[model samples]
Target: MNQANFDEARKAEANYHNELYSDHEILEPGTWMSKPVPIVMELLERILQHKDHVTVLDLGCGAGRNTIPLAVRLKGTNSRVVGIDLLEEAIEKLRENSNKYDVADVIEARKGDAEQVDILEDAYDYIAACGCLEHVSSEEAFIKVLERMKMGTRLGGIHCITMNTDIQEVERETGRALETLIELNLPTEKAFSILEEVYDGWNVLDRKTTLLSIDEEKYEKPSQFRCQSITFAVQKI
Candidate 1:
């Protein structure tokens, strides 16, 4: 698909999220996960060990799940995080939570597509785009966003990305598989193939590909689908 098509897909996804949040207050939130992913926090800790100041970008930062705690951890280090989400309510809720944690000064929130948001060259010190990439409707759009993120990171900068490589969706009532949105039907091998090219010069610190699932019923769906999640924490060369 072309850029225009990709833009339309993003708009549609944004509309979906807006509708999801329409029933409640921006700050009316529940836990998306039990806690911050330990590995992600560990990596951030290690990255901050040698830096006096850092700039972090948290893409698809839903409800400050990871953003708030990271800001608290990086407090007094002159570090700041800018969270970008397609849902305005998500960003607003993130901002509200940041204030509650007294990290409002360190966490800034923006409403926009993470892939389309502009950043200065070599700007971010660390980036996280967990549970986000599958939303990109086409391969071309995904590659463009990945390239942009790579270019925006400083040399030696680290990125933590998690993507659902291939997810077969089923109807709410029927277990039969249905087509996913646009070109998100990417298989596991294909997703890795793209990554092989995307991180050519970068060093992979940690990598894993597996089913993205939890035992919590709250996080379960009514449909029968298999989600292959790919995670990578890499440093720019």
Candidate 2:
């Protein structure tokens, strides 16, 4: 993606996250808001059940959207959660939420690109990358992240990841843009297809694809782009 598009995505992500967390409503099933609740609950429950106090690393943890809720639940545990994001603004929002929620001590938020998160490697018990990795410059770079993550995680750890799936309905513009990118060698299908190689040693605990509409009501304006979010979970065995 071009710098302008990249910047726009960052802005959109920040705006979306800010709105989602600042709201006080509990999302219920059968609604667009319910999309993340289930996955977050599953992640929270699994992390809490681990025998060892976890050292977590959340990749592309935009604006603490997932970090804060997860941190709130892990409050009493010995676990430590670190959220890392590529956008500086997203990091700022995370810090703001930490103070707003007063859980700064338990949740540490940092600004850095996950594609090169070298500071913490082979050091995490659970690593999560939600809706990330697809935007990497190249497929090889995307695969390289998993290799680094392996070195950073302990044996028998878990890696939870989510990304845009190959199957989706898109607006004419978005579809055209994606096709151009693919033609130029930015193979999103090829990129995510390598997940099998990246998590070769892990046990596939969850693997499913869900098709859902992007809640147009949730957005500030209507657009041609629609999306399908894919989620997968694996345990290092």
Candidate 3:
């Protein structure tokens, strides 16, 4: 994408999320924010087995869908889940939801681009980026973010990433294809290849790709979206 197109895409995405967060309540049924990603919860269970205190970074953590639950799980321990998002409304809702969930004390919510967020070396026990990498500016930026995530993780730590690949969208009424505004929309195989290349020496605890379809309204029009969803979990050796 050119600079202008990239900026437009980012703005659209930010506006979409801002409106979504403002309109919906946290954990409201029939929404993607209704529950934390299962893989993230599963990996947290594994992390708790061997460690008492943990630190986690949740990229693109919209409205504390995963961050709040992770904090609740790690309650009573010296653990924290730092959540970052590009939308201001998301961060506000995340704070409110964290308070409502009684996990505010353990959550650090920040508004920032996931691609540009700082990930200090050996800083996190777990890192999660769910449904977010496609919002990055480019494939190069995506890979750079992954490298930062890898370096930020502590040894024996876990990373769970879920992203949409090979996305297709169409107008529901006319059956005409619509442009997908995401920045890093790679094919499933290509995305996996990049993951494998970046995490070459890490232990692959889980990896899978599944096709999914969803009907929704976007840009005030009904649309259908299909994509290969990739779920990857790895442990740093």
Candidate 4:
């Protein structure tokens, strides 16, 4: 994908999210909105069940689909979540909803590009990158982001990264778009191998890939749309 394609895809994503944000359907299921992936919610519930006063970083946290519930879960506790997204509107909406849900104190909304893998400050108890990794520019960027994530996590910190392979995208084969969405097209097999190698010495909590059904009303290709999502829930060793 050229710069135009990348920009257009990003614009589409932002517009889609903005639409859902306007409709209050970004967090719901079986609606004309983007539903939170099951694995994401599952891991979050587990995280909450495991810790109370934890610090979290939510990457690609568009409009607080994941951040809101997390903040609500951590409200009144010493826990905190720093939510980041590329779209300023999404972050703004996140801020609004955080207050609406009375979790403004717990959620810190900011705008940042996930592909940059920017770690602001402090070691996080948990880091979540749902629907974020494939947006990276290249395999090298992927490795870099994961390495930074590992380095930024506490010794026992957990990370939940959920993303689609290139198969899920029409423009890029491997979803490693550097400069543009067409910068690289990595194979799924090799991608997994790299991940395995990268985590060779770390504790692997959970890693899997599956094709999940999409809501037709919300997805353009619902008839044949399936999210070939890869999920990694790991702990820093």
Candidate 5:
């Protein structure tokens, strides 16, 4: 999509969230996970090691699930954490939560897109992007964002990312007539193929396949739901 289209969609998303706050519980990150807290905490602890005076950035930091917690952890230290997302409401809610949860000063929330974020190169020690890549218009744009993140990080900086993977088995088992839905909305094995080919030098810390399931009610309709999961960390060269 063009910059104008990207920006307009982002603003609309922000407006939607701003007008609807309490109802924000419809769906969320890690909704598919049996134990999301532990998963997120594990990743945070691993990324925010004992580095003094480090800066961390969260791309697509929707509603501060990871942002607020990371800020709390980094508080009382020289470390700073910033969370950026396309939704104004997400950013606003994140800011309120930061204050309510007592990390407002440490965590700065902003409305931003990964493709257009402006930051100094090699300024951050750790960058995190959970459940975001698949939503981009294309894999090429996704990698471009990754490349920007890479440039925004210091040498040896860590990048934590989670993506939707191919889910043929789930589609078969669930009998979801969503193969086309999955293809159009979520990343596939081909997406990873592109990532592997493009970012050959990055280390793969952890890789896993997860089904996009929440509770016992597996979705089978033509919906906006993405249908797979993958998480891994890479160190910037």
Candidate 6:
């Protein structure tokens, strides 16, 4: 996507997320933000085995779905989870949810674009970017973000990422193909190739791709969305 197209798509995606965050309550059943991602929780357990006090960075964290739970798990320890999202509504909701869950002290919610945010080198013990990397403005930005994630992580730390690749969408009413709109959409094979290249020499603890299909409303139209969802976890050597 060019800069103009990328800006438009980014605006639309941010608006969609802002509306969702405004309309639904966190942890409400049946919603995408209903609960913390199971794989992230499982990975945290593994991290706890090695370190008691941890610092984590959660890119594209929406309304604290995973961030709040992470903070709750790390509560009473010298641990912090920094959650960043592009939508202001998501950041606001995340702060509210964190306070509601009594994990506010451990969570720092910030509004920022994941691709543009500055990640300090060797600053984080665990970094997660669930369903968010594909929103980057371009393929180059996506790869750059991964490089930053790698640099931000401390030795022996883990990075968990989940993103949709090879997205396909069609309007339900007209049965016409629609642009996926999100930036940085890549083929499944190419996405993995980039990940392997960026994370070369790192220990790939887990990697898998699953085909997913869902019906949802997009750009004010009913649509069917399909993609290969990639979940990868790696540890810094």
Alpha-carbon runs more than 4 Å astray in model 2: 1-37, 167-192, 215-221
Residue-level lDDT tens digits of model 5 in 38-88: 455565576656465668898878777677777877888867888898777
Please provide, for model 2 over 1-237, each residue's C-alpha lDDT reduced to its tens digit, 9 standing for 90 to 100. 666665555555556655654553222354343334366558657756755477788888876657777677677777788999877766777788777767787888888876777745568877788766755655667778878877788766777877765533234434332321210132345544687778776888777665545533223334333445566777778
Model 1, position 161: C-alpha lDDT score: 87
Per-residue accuracy of model 1 over 1-237 as CA lDDT, tens digit each: 566665665665565555544443332345334477667788788787878888999888877778887898888888889998878778877888888889988998998876688977899989988877777657877888889998899988998988777666565555655544433557888888887789998998988887764211111345444678888788987
User: What is the TM-score of each predicted model, taking all chains together?
Assistant: 0.83, 0.75, 0.97, 0.79, 0.75, 0.96
Q: What is residue 231's positional error in candidate 3, in angstroms?
A: 0.4
Instruction: Please write out the lDDT profile of model 3 over residues 1-237, one tens digit for every residue.
Output: 888887877876777778778888766697778888888999999998999999999999998888888999988898989999888888999999988989888999998987788889999999999998988988899999999999999999999999999998889889898888777789999999999999999999999988988876666688888899999999999
Candidate 6 runs further than 4 Å off: none
Residue 52, model 4, lDDT = 70
For model 6 the local lDDT of residue 40 reads 96
**Top candidate when judged by TM-score against the true structure:** 3
Give candidate 3's whole-model lDDT.
Answer: 0.89
State which candidate, 2 or 4, has the greater TM-score.
4
All candidates in order of lDDT, best leading: 6, 3, 1, 4, 5, 2
Q: In every candidate, how many clashes are there?
A: 0, 5, 0, 3, 1, 0
Q: What does the lDDT read for residue 183 in candidate 5? A: 17
TM-score of 5: 0.75
Write the residue-wise lDDT of candidate 6 on 1-237 in tens digits: 888888887887777778778888877786778888889999999999989999999999999889988999999998999999988888999999998999989999999988889899999999999999999877888888899888899999999999999998889888799977778889999999999999999999889999988777557888888899999999999
Candidate 4, RMSD to the unseen true structure = 5.2
Alpha carbon lDDT at 51, candidate 4 = 75
Candidate closer to the true structure by TM-score (higher is better), 5 or 6:
6
